[model samples]
Target chain A: AQTVTQSQPEMSVQEAETVTLSCTYDTSENNYYLFWYKQPPSRQMILVIRQEAYKQQNATENRFSVNFQKAAKSFSLKISDSQLGDTAMYFCAFESFGNEKLTFGTGTRLTIIP
Target chain B: EPEVTQTPSHQVTQMGQEVILRCVPISNHLYFYWYRQILGQKVEFLVSFYNNEISEKSEIFDDQFSVERPDGSNFTLKIRSTKLEDSAMYFCASSDFDSGGPYNEQFFGPGTRLTVL
Candidate 1:
């Protein structure tokens, strides 16, 4: 069984600043994938970024990046130069190769203050 | 430009009524999935379909929940007896391949909001 945990329930950041959302997971599988998904007020689940366990390089999508520490079982999402559009409920997900199920963290409500 | 699509953006059904959520995965994708999110909870996987059969499912998908790919393109989730707890937003997603790669991104649809009373 795999599980994802997001310790932070809510976080706020001023526009143009940076914010980091923490996430941890328990998985015995060595090879897997980590993902960050954003759900705005519209309630649409949008993929933010994804990191492959085999690759040590953290995944980056513009202002969004991941700090993946495989040994620590930690994968955190960092949003730089945050904007109002970035305000949403962010969820951390875990999925392994050949596995379709995605175990998700509780989620972190992020608010970008002007 | 390809994307997954789900029908019945919003559904209001009485308790114990059967509700069917429909989805059309990306045309070229082989893997399909159904995920649900309660009002303030994280998205939970319900089931995954591949090769014309169920590859995996979560505990939440009990005997009352069933999935079918009746035809070649549409994937459906049928809840035999809806409960208040079943009211949530259901999302459909699909991936081109399961292998980890840049293109393995799962495209999601707008989702269907099921409201049970």
Candidate 2:
């Protein structure tokens, strides 16, 4: 069994500021994948970014990036130049290399103050 | 761009009644999945389907829950008897196996809010 943990329940950052959301997981499998998903007021699950365990290089998507620490089993998301639209519930997810199911963290409610 | 789509943005049903949530994944995608999120909780994976059969399922998916792909396009999740605890937002997701791997990025649908009273 695998479990993801997001210790922060809520966070707020001023518009244009940078913010980092922390995530950690407990898994016995060495090969897996990590993901960050955002859900806004509309209640839609949107994929923000993803990282594969085999790749040590972090994944970056425009304003979104991740700091993946394989040995520590930590994967955190960094939002640069945060906008009001970035305000949403962010979730950390884990998927084993060959498995189909994704185990998700509780989530961190992020608010971008304008 | 192609995306996964779910029908009936919201559904209101009574306890013990049956409810079917439908989704049309990307036409080229070969894998389909169903997940749920209780209010203020994390998203939970319920089941995954491929090649006309379920490839994986979580403990949360009990006999009360079932999934089917009756046609080439539509994938459905049927809850035989809804419980109050079943009230949650259900999401449909799909992904294709590329050279990268089967663990390719999964595209998610808007989700359907199911309210069991």
Candidate 3:
């Protein structure tokens, strides 16, 4: 079974500042995908970004990027020039190749302070 | 852009009562899934459905729980006898299977908060 871990329970950053949310997972599978999802006050799960394990280059989506270290079993999300809208509960998820189930971390509540 | 949508944004029921959560997935999606999250807990996968049958299920999906796609657009999750522990946010998701590239990106719906008192 794959297990994802997000050590941080909460985080706060000033608006326009950069923030990084850490996540690690234990999986025996060689091929998989990692994802970051955000849940705001509306409580809707929104996909922030995703990274393929096979890709050496990290995934970047505008201000949201990921640092994926396959060997270390680490996938971290970085939010640059963060805005107030970025404040939400962030969760890290893992899905192995050919598997439909997604394992998710507990989540880190992030707040962007003005 | 298409997205998954769930009905009864919030439901409150007594323990031992039956509860059904409904969802409408993307029109073109081929796969459907159900997940739940207890308040302050991580999301947990319950079941995945494809071709009108269950493709995968987790330990959390016990005999008391069932899923059905009764019609063309509606996917439903039914808890036969709800327990207090069953109170949580139920989420419905769907994905399209593309043979080329790992394109099984699941789109999530705004979850329904189920409260069993």
Candidate 4:
């Protein structure tokens, strides 16, 4: 069984600043994928960035980047130059290599204050 | 941009009644999936389907739940008997198998809010 945990229930950042949301997971599978998704009030899940366990390089998508520490079972999302539109519920997810099931963290409510 | 779409944005049903959720995945996507999120809880995987059959399913997708692709563009999930616990947001997702990549990215829909009273 695999599980994802987001320790921070809520976080806030001033506009143009940066924010980091923490996430950890428990999985025996050596090869897997980690992802960050954003869900606004509209309820649509938008992909932020993804990191492959086999690759040590962290994934970056514009302002969104990830720090994936495979050994520590930690994968955190960092949003740089945050904007008001970044206010949303962010989720960390895990999916084993070639598997369809995606285990998700409890989610972190992020608010970008202007 | 092509994206997954689900119908019946909101549904309110009585307990013990049958409810069917519909989804129209991206045209070229070969894989389809269903996920659910209870209020303020983590999203949970329900099932995955490919080639007109179920490839895998979670324990939550028990006998009471079933999935079908009755047409070229429509995929549906049927809940035989709804419980109060069924009140949640149901999401439809789709992906194209990335044979050469490390992992495939699943695109999610806006989600359907289902409330069982």
Q: What is candidate 2's DockQ?
A: 0.78
Where is model 3 more than 4 Å wrong at Cα? B98-101
Any idea what lDDT model 4 has?
0.93
- Deviation of model 4 at A62, angstroms: 1.1
For model 2 the TM-score comes to: 0.96
Q: For all the predictions, what are the DockQ values?
A: 0.57, 0.78, 0.79, 0.90
lDDT of 4 by residue, A52-113 (tens): 99999999999999998999999999999999999999999999998887899999999999
Task: Compare candidates 3 and 4 on lDDT and give the better one.
Answer: 3
Q: Candidate 4 at A87: error in angstroms?
A: 0.9
- Residues B1-117 of candidate 2 have per-residue lDDT tens digits of 888899999999999999999999999888899999999888999999999999889899999999999999999999999999999999999988543564767888999999999
Better of 1 and 3 by lDDT: 3
A8-63 per-residue lDDT for model 1 (tens digits): 99999999999999999999998889999898987767899999999999999999
Segments in model 4 whose C-alpha atoms lie over 4 Å from true places: B98-100
Score each candidate by Cα lDDT. 0.90, 0.94, 0.94, 0.93
Sort by DockQ, best first: what order?
Answer: 4, 3, 2, 1
**Per-residue alpha-carbon lDDT of model 1 for B1-117, expressed as tens digits?**
777888999999999999999999989888899999898787889888889888888889999999999998999999999999999999999887755554456778889999999
DockQ of 1: 0.57
lDDT (10s digit) by residue, model 4, range B1-117 = 998999899999999999999999998888999999999899999999999999999989999999999999999999999999999999999998644556878899999999999
The residue-by-residue lDDT of candidate 2 on A11-56, one tens digit each, is 9999999999999999999899999999898876788999999999
By the DockQ metric, which is better: model 1 or model 2? 2
Off by over 4 Å in 2: B98-102
How much is the lDDT of residue A1 in candidate 2?
A: 91
Q: TM-scores, in order shown?
A: 0.93, 0.96, 0.98, 0.97
Better of 1 and 2 by lDDT: 2
Under CAPRI classification, how is model 4 graded? high
